[model samples]
Target chain A: MFLQQIINGLTVGGVYALIALGYTMVYGILELINFAHGEIYMIGAYLGIIFLGIFTTAGLTQYSLPLSLFLTVVLSVLFCSAYGFTVEKLAYKPLRNAPRLNPLISAIGVSIFLQNYVMLTQGATDKVFPHVLPVTTIEFSGITMTSLQIIIIVVSLLLMAGLHLFIMKTRTGKAMRAVAQDKVMASLLGIDIDRIISVTFIIGSGLAAVAGLMVAMYYGLVNYSIGYIAGIKAFTAAVLGGIGSVPGAMIGGFVLGLIESLGAGYLSSEYKDAYAFIVLILILMVKPTGLLGKSEGHKP
Target chain B: MLKLENIHTSYGHIEAVRGTNLEIRKGEIVSLIGSNGAGKSTTLMTISGILRPVKGKVIFEGREIQGLSPHKIVSMGVSQVPEGRRIFPKLTVRENLEMGAYLKGKGQRAKGKGSGVKGQEARGKGEDTSRGDSRIALAEQLDHIFNLFPVLKERQKQLGGTLSGGEQQMLAIGRALMSGPELLLLDEPSLGLAPIIVIKIFKTIRELNAGGLTILLVEQNAKAALRLAHRGYVIESGRVTREGIGKELLDDPAIKRAYLGE
Candidate 1:
C-alpha cells in the first residue's frame, strides 16, 4: 500500500515538475516569476483536448492509438511553443528594462488575460478528455500497476533527462546560461539576448505542454480555471526546489508531490492543498533560497 | 577601422559622453585615458553599441553602426572586453571560452542569421564534427588563447568566480579574442590588479597590437595605457582635452603632473 502511494505521488509529481520547470527557467533567466506560465500550461491542456477531439472526429483514434497520440503530442507541443514565444514577445519583452515590480504586475495581468481568454473561448465548464490510453494492469504479488502511470512516469523522466542533457551539453545551452549570468556580457560575446530569451520560453512552454497532456490523460478532464490552482501548486514546487536552479525545480516538484499525496492519505484529504503552502512557508522560513538554491557563496 | 564623429551619449538627462570624438586606424593601438567620470568607458560603450550616441555618427568600416545592437556590432568584428572583467562567473573556464567563440561556433551570429529560436535543432555538441573546418579554426583559437594565458589552460575546469582577479582579466581578454575581432575595445584592463600583473597584461596588449590587431583601450591607469599605445587621447568632463602620439603625451609635463603623478 505504501509503495502504491509512492508510485501515485511520483506520477502526479512528475507532472508538477514539468509545469514547474517553465516557471523556474524563466525566473532563472529573467528573474521574473512568470505568473503567465500556469496559463500556458492550461492552454497546453486545452490544445491537447482540442487535438484529441480532432483525431476522434476524424476517426483516427479508431485506427491506431500510437499514431493518434503522436499527432496530439506533436501538435500540442508545437502550438504551445509558439504561444509561449508570442507571449514573451508581446507581454514581457517590452518591460525588460522596467523596474522589477512593473514586470511582476505585467506577468499577473498576462495570467488573468490568458485565463479569461480561455474561459470565454472554451467555456467555463470542464472539458472531458477521452480515455484514449489503454488501462492495462501489471500486477506483482499484491500490488497492481496501471500502464498509464508507468507511461506518465517514463515520459516525464525522459523529457527531464533530455532537458538536462540539452542544458549541459550544447552550445545554445551554454549561451543561455551565460545570458542568465550576465545579459550584457552575453550580448558582448555575440549572443543574441532576445533570441536566447525566446528560446528559453519555448523550451519551458514545450515541457509544460507535455505535462498538460499527461495530466489530461491521467485525470481525463481539463477546465480553463484549472490553471490558477495548478499554477500556484507548480510555483510552490519551483520555490520549494530553488527558483533559479534547474535540478532544484525538478527535485522540488517530486518532493512536493510526495508530500501532498502522503499528507492526504495519512492526514486529511480536505487539507491536501494546504500542505503545499505549508511546506512552501516552512522552506521559505528555514532556507529561503529553496532546496538546492544556487549558492552565491560558491565562487562562480 | 573605427571612427566616432562628435558623439554624445547620456544617462537620462546627464550626459556621460559629451561631444567626444575618437578614431582607431587599422592595426594601430589607441588608448583613451581619463579619470573617473571622464567618459572613457562611456566612449567605449558607445563604440561597442551598448549605448547609442544621441548625436553624431559612429562609422566602423565606413558603415554607420551607432544604433546597432551589441551582438550585431560584435559580429561586425567589433568586440568589447567591458569594465570590471564581466566574465560569466557561474560558468567553468572552458564553458566561458566556448561562449567566447559563440559566433564562430555557428558562423551565422556574425551575419545575424542564426537564432536561438530553432534551438530544438541545437542537438548535442558531439555532432559538431560535421563542421570540421570551423571546429579546427576554433581549436586553433583555443590554442592561441591557451598560449596567451597558460594559467587559464591549467585551471580550465575551475569556476570563473573562483579565479584570482588577474586570472579573470586574462580570461576576459581571451574570451574576447575568441570572436576573432578586428577592432577590440578594452575598458579598464588594468583595474585593481597587482602592478606586476598589470605589466604582463600591458605587455600582452603590446604584443597583440604588434601582431596586427587594432585596439581601442580605455584606462584610468594613464601611465601604463599611454606607454603601450601608438597614439593616445585624454578626456575630462566627457570631452577630448588632448590627442597626441603615445610617447609625446607620456613626456608632456602637464600630463605627467596630472595623470602620471610625477
Candidate 2:
C-alpha cells in the first residue's frame, strides 16, 4: 500500500511540478504571481482534447500511440505558448511600469476572464477524454503497475529534465537568470529584457499545457473549472518549494503530491485537499520562503 | 567618443538633469563631480540608457543613442558599473561576470572571429550556446580585472551578496570589465568606502584608463575624482556649472573652496 501510494504521489507530484515551473519562472523575473497562469494550463488540456477529438473523428487512428502523443504535445504547447504570449502582450505589458499591485489585480482579472470565457465556450460539463492509451498491467515481484502510471511518471520526468537542461545550459536560459537577478543590470549587459520576459512566459505556459494534457489523459476527463483547484494546488506546490526557486517548485510539488496521496490512502479521500493545505500552512509557518528559497536580506 | 548635448531628465515632476551637456574623447577618464542630489548620477544614467532624457541628443560612436534601451546601448560597447554595486546576490561571482559578456558572445560567434571548434562553442555552450560562449569569453577577460584587483580571483566562488562593500565594488567593476566595453560608465565608485580603499580604487581606475578604457565617472569625492580624471565637469542641480582640464579645475579657487574643501 505504501509503495502504491508512493507511485500515485509521484505521478500527481510530477504534474504539479510541471505547472508550478511556469508560475515560479514568471514570478522569478517579473515578480508577479500571474494569476492567469492556472487558466493557461486548463486551456492546454482543452486544446489537447480538442486536437485528439479531431484526429479521432478524422479517422487517423493508424498513427502510433507515441506519434499521436507527440503531435498532441507539440500542438498543445504551441497553442498554450501563444496564449501566454498574448496574455502578456495584451494584459501585463501595458502595465509594466505601473504599481506592483496593479499587475497583480490585472492578472486576477485575466484569470477570471479566461475561466468564465472557457466555461461559456466549452460549456460547464466535464468532457470525457478518450481512453486511447493501452492498459496493460505489468507485475514484477508482487508489485503490479499499469502502463498509464508508468507512462505518466516517465513523461513527467523527461519533461522536467528537459526544462532543467534548457534553463541551466542555454543562452536564453542564462538571459532569464540575468533578468531574474537584476532587470536593470541585465539590460545594461545587453540582454533584451522584453524578449527574455516573453520567452519566460512562453516556456512557463508551455510546461503548464503539457501538465494539463497529461492530467486530462490520466483522469479521463477535463472541465473548464479544472484550472481552479489544480491551479491552487500547483500554486501551493510552487510556494512549498520556494516562490521563485525552480527546483523548489519541483520539490514542493512532489511533497504536496506525496502528502495528499498518503492522506487520501490512510486517512480519508475526502480530506485529500485539506492535507495539501495543512502542509502549505505548516511550511509557511516554519520556512516562509518555501523549502528551497533563499532569504533575500533587506538592503538598507 | 561619446557626447551628450542639452540632456534633460526628470523624475516625475521634478527635473533632475536640466539640460546637462558633457563629452568624453576616446581613452579619457572624464569625471563629473557634484554634491548629493546635484544630478550627477542622473547624467550617467542618461548616458548609459537607464533613464531616457526628456530632451537631448546622446551620440556614441557617431550614432544617436538618446532613446535606445539600456541593453542596446550595451551592445554598442557601453557598459555601466552602477551605484550600490548591484551584483546578483544569489549568483556566484563567475556567473555574474558571464552575464556581462552576453552580447559580445553572440557577436563573436556570428563573426567566427576566434578559434574554430576548439573555441567558445566547444566549451559546452548551453541554452544560449552562442551567448554563453561570449559570456565565457567575458569571464576570460577577467584576468585583466583580476590582475588589477587580485582579491576577486580569491573569492570568485562566493555569492556576490556576501562580499564586503569594497569587494562588492571590485566585483561590480570586474563584472563590467568582462563585457569588454569601449566606454565604462561608473556612478559613485567612492560612495561608501574607506579612504584607503577609495585610493586603491581610484588608482585602479587610473591604471584602467592608462590601458585604454574610456571612462565617464560620477563621484561625490571631488578631490579624488578630479585627481584621477583627465578632464572634469562640475554639475550643480543637473547642469554643468564649470568644465576644464582636471588639474585646471583642481587648481581653480572656486572649485577648491566649494568642492575640494581647500
Candidate 3:
C-alpha cells in the first residue's frame, strides 16, 4: 500500500513540478507573483479539449490517435503561450516602473479576469476529456502502476531536462540571468530587457500548458475552476522549495505530493489539501528563505 | 566625437543637469569634475540614454541620439561604467564579461553589424566574422581584457561579489570593454579605493586613451582627473562653471580653492 501511494505521489508530483516551474521562473525574472498564471494553465486544458473535439469532428482521431494528440498538444501550447505573452504585454509591461504593489494588484486583477473569461466562455459545467490514452496496469506484488502514470513521469522529466539544458548552455539564458541580477547594468551591456521578459513569459506558459494537458489526461475531466486549486498547490510547492529557484520548485513539487499522498493514505483523507500548508509553515519557521533560496541584498 | 547641448534633466520636480553643454573631440580624455549632486553622474546617465533629457540634444558621431534606448546607445559604440560598479554578484567574473559582450554574440552572426567603432581591428570591429571565427574573436577579446588587467584573468572563475572593491571596479570596466566601445563613459572610478589602487586605475585609463579610445571620465578626485585629462570642465549647480586646458585649470586659483582643496 505504501509503494502504491509512492507511485501515485510521483504521478501527481510530476504535474506539480511542471506547473511550479512557471511560477518560479516568472518570479525569478520579474520578482512578481504572476497570479494569472493559474488561469493560463486552466485555459491550456480547455484548449486541449476544444482542439481534441475539433479533431474528432474532422474524423482525424479515427485515423491516427498519435497524430491527433500531437496536433492537440501543439495547438494548446501555442495558444497558451500567446495568452501568456499578451498578459505580460498588456498588464505587466506598463507597470514595470510602477510601485511593486501596483503590479501585484494588477496580477490579481488579471487572474480574476481570466478566470471569469474562461468560465463564461466554456460554461461553468465540468468538461470531460476524451479518453484516448491506452489503459494498461502492471502489477508487482500488491502494488499496481498504470501506463498513464509512467507516461506522465517520463514526459515531465524530459521537459525539465530540456529546460535545464536551455538555461545552462544558451546565450539567451545567460542574458536572462544578467537581467534578473541587475536591469540597468544589463541594458548598459546591450541586452534588451523587454524581449527577455517576454521570452520568460512565453516559456513559463508553454510549460504550464503541458502540465494542464497531462492533468486533463490523468483525471479524464477538467473544469474552469480546476486551475484555482492546482495553481495554489503548485505555488505552495514553489515557495516551499525556493520561490525563485528552478531546481527547488521541482524538488518541492515531489516532496509536497508525497506529503499529501501519505497524509491522505494514513492520517485523514479529509485534510489532504491542508498538508502542503502545514509543511510550508513549519519550513518557513526554520528557513525564511525557503529550502534552496539564498538571501539577496537590495541593489543601491 | 560626442557633444551635449543644453541638456536639462530632472528627477521628479528637481532638475539635476540644467542647461549643461559639453563636447569631447575624437581621441581626447575629457573629465567632468564636480561636487556631490552637481550633475556629473546625471550628465553621464543622460548621454548613455539611461535618462531622457527634457531639453537639448546628445549627438554621437555626428548623429542625434538623445531619445534612443540604453541598449541601442550601447550598440552604437557608447557604453557606460555606471556609478557604484554594478557587477552582477551572482554571475562569475567571466559570465559578467560575457554579458558585456551580449550584442556581439548570436545576433552578430545574423546581423553582421558590430558597434560604431572605426580604425581599430582588434578593439571594436566585429563584422565579417563567421561562427567559428566569432568564437575565436570572443576568446581573443577576453585575452585582450586579461592582458589589460591580469588580475581579472586570475579571478575569471570567481563570482563577481567575491572580488574586492578594486577588483570589482576592474571587472566593471572590463565588462564594458567587451562590447568594444569607441566611446567609454566612466563614473567615479576612484571612489572608495586605496590610493595605490586609484593610481593603478588612472594609469590604466591613460593607457587606454593612448590606444585611441575616447574617454569621458567623471570623478570627484578633481586633481587626478584634471591632471590626466587633456581638457577639463568644472560643473557647479548643473552648469559648466569653468572650462580650460588640464594644466591651466590645475593652475587656476579659484579652481584650486573650490575643488583642489588648496
lDDT of candidate 3 over B1-262, digit per residue (tens):
9999999999678899999999999889999999999999999989988889999999998999999999889888888999999999988999998888888885452322332222233344444433365567688678778887899999999999899999999999999988878889999999999999999999989877876788999999999999999999999989998998999999999999999999
Of the two candidates 1 and 3, the one with more favorable DockQ, higher being better, is 3
State model 2's lDDT. Answer: 0.84
lDDT of 3 by residue, A1-300 (tens): 898888888888988888898999989999999988888999999999999999988989989999999999999999999999999999999999898998989999999999899888999999999876688999989999989899998998999899888876677888888888888889889998999999999999998999999888889898988888888889988988899898898888888898889889999989988988898788789886778888777765
CAPRI grade of model 2: medium
Candidate 3 local distance difference test against the native: 0.88
Task: Indicate the worst ten consecutive residues by lDDT in candidate 2 chain A.
Answer: A57-66
Candidate 2's residue-wise lDDT over B27-99, tens digit each?
Answer: 8999999898999878878888889999989999799998889877876778899888788887777677677
What digit string (tens of lDDT, one per residue) describes model 2 on residues A1-300? 888888889989999989899889998998899889999999999999988777767666456666776788899999999999999999999999999999999999999999999999999999988777778988776667778778878887888889888887777787788789888888877788999999999999999998999888888889998888888899899999999999999888888899899999999999988887887788789988998988885432
CA RMSD of each candidate after superposition: 5.3, 4.8, 2.6
The 0-to-1 C-alpha lDDT of every candidate, in the order given, reads 0.87, 0.84, 0.88
Residue-wise lDDT of candidate 1 within A34-96, one digit each (tens)? 999888898999999999889988999998988998999999999999999999999899999
Error in Å for residue A106 of model 2: 1.3
Best candidate, DockQ-wise?
3
Candidate 1 vs candidate 3: which has greater lDDT?
3
- Give per-residue CA lDDT, model 1, range B1-262, as digits (tens): 7889999999678899889888889878899998888888788888888888899999998899999998889888887899999878889998999898898887664331111111111221222222346678678668768887899999999999899999999999999988777778899998999999999999988777665578899998888899888999999999999999999999999999989999
